[model samples]
Target: MASFSEREQAFENKFKHDAELRFKIIMRRNKLVGLWAAGLLGHTGDKAEEYAKSAVESDFEKPGHDDVIAKLMADFQAAKQEMSEHRLLKQMEEMLDEAQRQITAE
Candidate 1:
């Protein structure tokens, strides 16, 4: 078995890496949200930032695209919306799984 300090250091490293990953995920999500809001609301740079903030703060009530995934893939060369949605969902799953692992490890 690893010594206490060794285990502690490993845990700290894992936590830090996970946090960095989460930060990147949030930043990426913010960009997508900003793009969507700006295009939809006719907002520009700073205004888009404001819209993004507001959207992030509130419950974003956009319609789910689950039903249209197959159509989107068939119609578009690149399944953009589907890929972004998948990334977002995967990040959420990873974060939740990481939390569970941490809880169990403790």
Candidate 2:
């Protein structure tokens, strides 16, 4: 049987792992979506990387990915790029899986 301290340590370890995983997943997802949006907006090379970082930063504007989506949608519209919200949502879902796989592999 584990003592109280041992059980507490195990719980702390699990919490830390979970938090780190969540952070990695969100960051990876943001990078993937940023790259996709950059491509749509004709950004390449360093410009695309900068845009990707912006995407990651946008996520901090609010809870969840609402801010990111809003920013991308507005940018698309402003750039006269035609992209349905549904398509963006789909890409987000796909990117999430890719992000999970990427973090798992790292």
Best by lDDT: 2
Candidate 2, position 33, lDDT: 99
TM per prediction: 0.42, 0.94
Q: After superposition, how far is residue 80 of candidate 1 from its true place, in Å?
A: 24
Error (Å) of candidate 1 at residue 88 is: 11
What's the lDDT for all of these models? 0.50, 0.95
Pairs of residues clashing in candidate 2: none
RMSD of each: 11.2, 1.3
lDDT (Cα, tens digit) per residue for candidate 2, span 31-88: 9999999999999999999999999999999999999999999999999999998999
The regions of model 1 sitting more than 4 angstroms off are: 59-106
Top-scoring candidate (TM-score)? 2
**TM-score of candidate 1 against the unseen true structure:** 0.42
Clashing pairs in 1: none
